[model samples]
Target: MIKTAFALSFALSTCMVLPALGAEQFQCPLPSNPNDPAKLEQIRGLLPDVNTMKNIERLNATIATLRRDGVSKSLMIDHLVGAYCLMVVREAPLTEAEKAALVRRFTGQVTRLVYSLESGLDIIINVPLTPDVVDAVNSVAEKQGLSGPAWIAMTIDDALQQQRTTSPPELPAGFSSSC
Candidate 1:
């Protein structure tokens, strides 16, 4: 009985130790002082060669600022780290699908970018769209008998109305409204 107990303890201890030993050496650091150049340089060194080091640095700074602006969640920090790393190293902007995925991951909603216009004002907001999207929007606008901008405005208004009719806002899982 003693021998069996010893074996079980040993197995459990080894399982715990192995994970610690196999853990990654370099983690994306979220140090208290993000502006520290020395620490930033150390993280920069861990990355593979990429042409957009400045972009990475800028993204890091932006993340740090965001965290300081009261967004403190480990999952969000990790997501931002992964997203920025992939974005900079890949040397390409995230595709529309990728952006949607990121937004869903972070926000827990399948939402489009919504803009608000002030009531009783004739204002124009310039939203640049990809060529393909522009073509699609133009087609839809023509079919709806509205200008492209008017179609977009109507769509946004409809979405807003739908949200208001819902009992409560559906937020992302694990989302803290404070952030």
Candidate 2:
């Protein structure tokens, strides 16, 4: 279980990078619903194979980049899962014990960070977009045969990915804020 803030950060990496237990958010199971799993799978497919040490280091480096960018903890975890574990749960034939560990891995990390006020089943955030943006999302959603909500979720993930790639690395040590 996670103990300190350091442990909390380490947990994020291990949940995807070190785990035999693959995770979904909120300590939940890998989704059985085709709609969401399909979404997860799409993100999953877009990532490099994370089964190697170099890829693990690459993902950990991404966390460092996001941290420097001052992203929220939830967004960090979301990206970690998307970048590493989504492909895992889909492709690996895990045992029952492994699945249970998956549940524990996320639950432990989440327990250290948040208190739940809603059912895990309905754990979601409502984001408000401009009407024109909504119309564009809707048009694209319809063309792809995806529900509006699902497409929006996909778009958010895409935006997060863009943010991840574009965030600049840390400045050199001599570039002091002490001016």
Per-residue alpha-carbon lDDT of candidate 2 for residues 1-179, written as tens digits (9 for 90 to 100): 11332233333334333334343422332322334455454444544563422454554454455557664545545544543444445545765456445534433333222222324685588877779767866665544334456544544544455567799556797796455
Which residue pairs in candidate 2 have backbone atoms (N, alpha carbon, C) closer than 3 angstroms, thus clashing? none
For every model in order, what is the number of clashing pairs?
0, 0
Model 1 Cα shift for residue 116 (angstroms): 15
Which parts of model 2 are misplaced by more than 4 Å?
A: 1-47, 50-56, 68-70, 99-179
* Shift in Å, residue 128, candidate 2: 42
TM-score of each: 0.28, 0.29
lDDT of all predictions, in order shown? 0.41, 0.45
- Clashing pairs for model 1 are none
Model 1 whole-model lDDT (C-alpha atoms) = 0.41
Provide C-alpha RMSD values for all models, in order. Answer: 25.0, 17.1
